[model samples]
Target: MTIVRATFLDTPTGETAMGAELRAATDAALRVVDGTIVERGAWADLGGRHTDDDVLDLRDGLVLPGLVDTHVHYPQVRVTGALGMPLLEWLDAVALPEEARLASPDYARAVAREFIGGLAGAGTTTALVFGSHFATAVDALFDEAQRVGLRVTAGLVVGDRGLPEALLTTPERAYAESIALARRWHQSAGAGSSPRTRYAVTPRFSYGATDALLESCQAVLKDVPGSWFTSHVNESQAEIAAVARLFPDATDYVDTYDRHGLVGASSVLAHNVHPTDRELRLLAGQGATVAHCPTSNAALGSGLFPLRAHVDHGVHVALGSDVGAGTGFSLFKEGLQAYFVQQLLGEAGLPLGPADLLHLATRSGALALGLDDEVGDLSVGKAFDALWLRPAETSPLALALRHADSASEALARTFALAGPADVAGVWVAGEPVKS
Candidate 1:
């Protein structure tokens, strides 16, 4: 058992509505045993209560819940800045060919090491990642994640057509391989039968999926309890047009997945930047969550997401690095990007606060992945998936936060200036993975 003493911040109850109260605790202490946080409160209070536990004092630093990423491509790590081609064209030019390289087992393992190490260095403890086309590559990814002790929910990218021949797979092969991988790793345990990973049913997107592929994806999710489904939707003008042309029978882009029984509470769809008002309503009604990949959207020239509208409609939204389309893997930068794009939308944007942005990067993404109960916040019964931020004296963020009179102001400064350099440590399941 261990007791961590630190200044803590998290949105314990989930996203705060605009101008609503944000949940935060200062000078906090967490009591962790068997990889789960058993208690949390003001440091003085918990110190008195848990005197027997070993201590890791981070009292001079800030401890935030480990960031949760809703959408990131494991195979697209190296091609981030190949810019200006929008969605379809960019995929054709660089994304596909780069992803295809993972077909080599050795190359896939090497990239997996880089990708998982990058996530740890950026302080992301939990992520819903898009995996490679090759099942062996996906195997390498899961193996590396376990070896590094990060919480990853990932799967093979299933595509029947509209992708490179090297990346394509028949619907039958997709179903067999996806389900087999799930059987091998989904809800899998370490030595104690305590689960540290999950499997998602992932089809590349509307462009790569035929009706047969999507139905097979639905089967994988249904056949495996606690599994999830994720894919892209309404991301760019050209992608939307092509999807519309491809699926004329469907009413809209969101409908393309909904008709296949894929939209629901456990499913996560990325980049609803161009979703119609009706689609937003359907998403909210169906309890589906959207991963607002603002960096990727802006990078690909995808439209600004309707942040305020989604909030007004009660749609659940989370942040994603969408790495490759997104320039980096840091969820803090993703938070900043989300705020920047919404600000670009003027009055259409929500009354965003730093706490809201933090929540989007952590709790909201955890909720979207159905792991909110286990990893989202610093609440009791949650695992100690957390990041420690220690601002250097020479850093401007330190000076700015020093004068901030409120928690909100200080948190905003943290997001504005605290890049990967400020992350002093990272923990997953009560154990340090980065320090």
Candidate 2:
């Protein structure tokens, strides 16, 4: 058992009258036993009771739940700044070509290490990573995640069309490879237990996947009972127009996946930047979650996310740092950009508060990935997945934090000014993953 003393801030789990309010614990102690938080209370009480237990003092800064990334591409880490091109053009000019290089096992292993390091260094403990087109590369990703102990749900990215020939796979081969990868990495423990690394049936996007390939993706999900599903959605007008032309019978971009029964509670579709009202309704009714990749949307010149419309329609929303096009792995940047996007939309935007930003970055992502029961907040029953923000004393963030007027203001400033450099420490399941 270990006891950690810190000033922790997390969003409340479940519904409450205090809606979107942050749960703050100043000078508090958490008793963690085998990675799970067993006890939490004021330090004065828990400290006196557990006098002999090992203590990890983190009072030098604020502790928050380890950030959760709902959508990020594993192969695109090296191409983050290949910007100025729109979505499809960016994929052709930079992203896809880089992704194809992962076919080399040695290259994949090296990229996997750098990708995992980038995530942990940026304070993300749990992520829904879009895996590579190559099965061996996806295996390398799971291997690195397992070695590092980060919670990752990733799988072989399958597409039968609209991509380079090297990245394409037949439907039968896609099914076989996906099932094989899922069998290997989807569960480290016995069946029904949540493993640190799981599988997600990723179908690149509607324009890239044919009806036959998507059917195989659905079959993979059916075979693996608890595996996840993720894909790109209405991201840019040009991409949407291409998808519309490909699937003439489909009503919209969401219909292309929904027609194949791919949208559901287990599905996480990224970048619904131009989702129609009907698409939003279908997503909400099916209990699917949308990953709002704010930075990528702006960097690719995609339109502002319809956050207010999604909220009004009861669609679940989570933040994703769509790295490569997204700028970086920092959730702080994503949250800040989300705030900026909403502000730029005027009445069409949902004015977000500090609590809202925090919730979206952490708890909202956990809920989206169906890991809320295990690792979202600093609640007693959750895993001790957290990050400590201890900016250098001479830095502007530190000086701003020292003179902040309130906890909310401090949190706002954190979103506004903090970056990966400010993340002094990060832990996942009671194990220190970064320092």
Candidate 3:
């Protein structure tokens, strides 16, 4: 057993901040223990706290739960700047073609390394990622995540129809491959002693996946019991119209997935820009999560997400970069985008504030992925996954809110305005993955 301590900030409830200071600081000490955190009257009574472990003092840097990106495409990393088209056209022109390359194991493996490295470097430790249609691509991502000791949930993109032919999976093949991959990687252990990888059932979106294909994906969930289902819903105007045309029998775009048993607690539906009150109510009733990709929505002209409405309705809303369409891997930038998009819609006024943004990036994101209990916070029993930010001498966080130039600057601004940026290191499951 080992004990490492530092100034800690965590959100015990979604609304309150819990801060603690340890007398002796040890850098990344949780990597050694196994078992639960013992409670000691509002504090964790660490039973076997070791005093001799290596120490890492963040020098008062802000250490919060590692950022969680609820939505992103691993294969789209190469097409970051492809612009102008809406979701459907973009998918046809740039996204699908690039994803087609993942059919090669070697190519998939190399891309997986880059994707995970990029996410980690940006302080994202947990992500609900979408891989190419190739099952090998999903496997490669899981393998790379295991190597880096990051907590990742991903799956094969099951677009059996309407996608580029090279990137398509037959309905039967999609089901078989999804099940095979889930059984192999979902909840699989990492290089460490505990399970670090999980699988989600991905159907691309209603437009790309045929009714038969969506059903097959739902069937995989029924078979797997606890498998997660991820898909795009109500992202763009064209996509919405396409879904209505494709599934005329369904009342709306959200219903297409709901009818297919794709809407539920373990499901993550990206976008909801055009969802109706009824759709939002259905999502809330079903305990489904909405991954709000504000940057992507804005970039693709996907319309502003009704964040206030979703929050008022008690729907679980998390922030996602939605890379390629969303533009960056940093959840901090995603938070800033979310804040600005809502402001543009006049739904909320600015100085949207950093604490709220941090909550969305961390706790809210984890909740969306059904991973709130394990990650998203710095509680003693939770996985020791966190990012240490080092602010510039003038307090970069403060400068960010007013004069931010880059995503990193925005993150520093988040810490300054709402929290602090003393990130001297990052730890995943008690192991220091970066410093």
Candidate 4:
């Protein structure tokens, strides 16, 4: 068995903060055998013995469940921070052109490596990613994620309309390609003892997919149980207008997906900035999740999300970077932006606390993507995907948040506050990936 000592916080029951905190001034033992958290309570458990195997001495620093980004576009990593513009114009000028480059297998592979590395560096262990349209690009992303031992759910972007011809896929071809990719990746053990890599059925959005294409994408779920379905919803005013013009028979944008059987427990819809009460209720009733990309919303002028409304209505809400459009891959920054965005809406008249932000980044995100059972918490039986945080010596959580530097600092300061630079180490499964 292996033992590591640190100040640990595990979000038991997925309610945000740890119901309890375990602080060991000297040392606390962590038992890991065969890549599982065997024991993690008190130092004297297991015969008062400790093994030298991978003992991470976090000192007084914090150890929490690694951040999980519920929504992000891996192919848009290169387009982040493009000059601000509305959704359609941004897509035309920056987003689409940058994503189109992924057609090159070598380019996709190279970017995949960097994208995964950025996630680890930002303390995100698990993510629901959106890969580029090319099947080879999607394969390249999966390969890189598997090599890095990161838990990722990604899919080939299905866009048949309103996009460059090179990026379009017919309804029939989109279904076939998605099914083949799902069969190849979505499982716990593939070929041998290799860990599972999930595949999401990603229809770029309502505007880009026809009724036939959307139905075909959703139909794949019948064959692949537990597969995730994601798409953009109610993001921009123009997109909503386009969706309305495209599906006039449907009640709203949400209904368009509902007609295709795309709204369900395993569905993840990003940017519900303009979702109506009916749509929110549908999402809640169907147990679908909405990934709140506050930064992207602000960057693309996509109006603020009704976070309080969503939470009050019992919708499953999680955090996302929404990269390129959302800007920044750091969940820490996203968490702070989430708080500010909500505060602007006067959410309870107070900003979200660190625990609230942490919840959205961890358990809530995992639940949104339907991976709560495997990740999001550091329970005894859960996978040891965690981030080790070392706060500056001057502060012990209190001082960090009080003196925030950047918007990202405002969020990271709440947890560690030193910055991403203070992220001392990251571990996926039971192995360390960064330090």
The best candidate in terms of TM-score? 2
Scored by lDDT, model 4 comes in at 0.79
Output the worst ten-in-a-row residue range by lDDT, candidate 3: 16-25
- The C-alpha lDDT values of all candidates are 0.87, 0.92, 0.74, 0.79
lDDT of 1 by residue, 196-257 (tens): 77888999998888999889888888888888889999888888899999999999998888
**What does the lDDT come to for candidate 3?**
0.74
TM-score of each: 0.96, 0.98, 0.86, 0.90
Candidate 2, position 256, lDDT: 92
Clashes of each: 0, 1, 11, 2
Over all chains combined, what TM-score does candidate 4 have? 0.90
Cα deviation of 398, candidate 2, in Å: 0.4
Residue 125 of model 2, lDDT score: 99
Residues 1-435, model 4: lDDT tens digits: 556666565555744322222222224556666656878776655435554465656755567788999898998888789866899999999889888899999999998998988888888899999888999999998898888888898888998888988899998898888878876787742562234478788999989988988888878766677788888999989999998998889999999899888899999999999889999889999999899898899988889788767776778888889987876778878877887886788734335766677778898888887677777877778778888877556655546644555433444465433346657788887788887
Candidate 1: stretches off by over 4 Å? 15-20, 188-194
Task: Give residue 203's lDDT in candidate 3 (0 to 100).
Answer: 88
Winner of 1 and 2 under lDDT: 2
Best first by lDDT, ranked: 2, 1, 4, 3
Judged by lDDT, which candidate is best?
Answer: 2
